[model samples]
Target: MTKYRPSKNSDGFTIIELLIVIAVAAVFGALTAGMLANATDIYSDSLERQKFISEVRSSFFKIIREATWQKSYTSFAGSNNKKLNIYSTDGKSIDYEIRNNNDIIQNNDQVSGSNNEILTDKIEYSSSNVYYLDQQGTGIDIVSQIENVRSLKLDFQFSNDTDDLRLQSHTLPYNLRIGRAMSYHE
Candidate 1:
């Protein structure tokens, strides 16, 4: 009877084949890890943007509420000027001025002359923007350039035509959108 012998080559994968398999597995693992990392980064950025937007909206609404409740200035400038002179939140002062240009200037706290404090920057007028002020009256990270902003209407609801407000309605009739696109380059 012939001696039966098992071939070594048929027993399992060759060393080269094992190495190739390992390389493929390593590549797949790397890809998966990279994808996961990218997703995490995007999620984190979205959260931060949402927080910023919420804060901006809150500040704007607060200002509108105050305007509606106080209703200090019937006219912007005068009886025929179409402008109103309203006192600032701080009762001791009456230096806050709202102009026809939709710009608000809060004068500095002084017993005499009024120094302008621009609440919203020039770029923010056209765009639905948010402004952050530092302790030194410097603006930082003014996120303007909104996608679309047709109108930003602030209506003061009064109990009667006398401008004594019972409630206020702040409406963004058009798109009230805000976003930031970030690009990365090696």
Candidate 2:
């Protein structure tokens, strides 16, 4: 046979074709990485929001319990509209207020042990969701006590740049409503 010569139609990839394939693979890999990073960010944000909501709910219930327990001596503190004062017979008093303009703070000087309790670190105070009663029987802004307030409404809001979670509850010396209803019935 003469010098061997290869056919042009061989069933194999050329250098240009191989290079194109590698480029396409690299593009796909980049896209996948970006997608994964975005997903992780979303998951983290969701988890933070859930934790914030849980804390708000737990704090609301805790305050309700404490307010109920102090029903006998719960009173609207005249000095601070945002604060609800509970005084025991022994002169010890506990003050509950939304401090730092948003976070709930409990000043339990009445307790021989323990200090102020921070109800929650995440509060969207600027949302205008929190409210309290004026001296009258009407609901009003927490920052302002118009008259003889009958109760306080603790409306907590937790939020991130994109989402918001809120919970609300009213505080009335536990027996106030019940006692009033009973008297009316009698």
Give me the candidate number with maximum lDDT: 2
Clash pairs (backbone) in predicted model 1: 75-83, 75-84, 76-83, 76-84, 77-83, 77-84
Looking at candidate 1, the ten consecutive residues that score lowest on lDDT are 74-83
Q: Pick the candidate with the highest TM-score.
A: 2
Model 1 / residue 170 / CA error / Å: 4.3
The CA lDDT of each predicted structure is 0.40, 0.63
Alpha-carbon error at 130 in model 1, in Å? 16
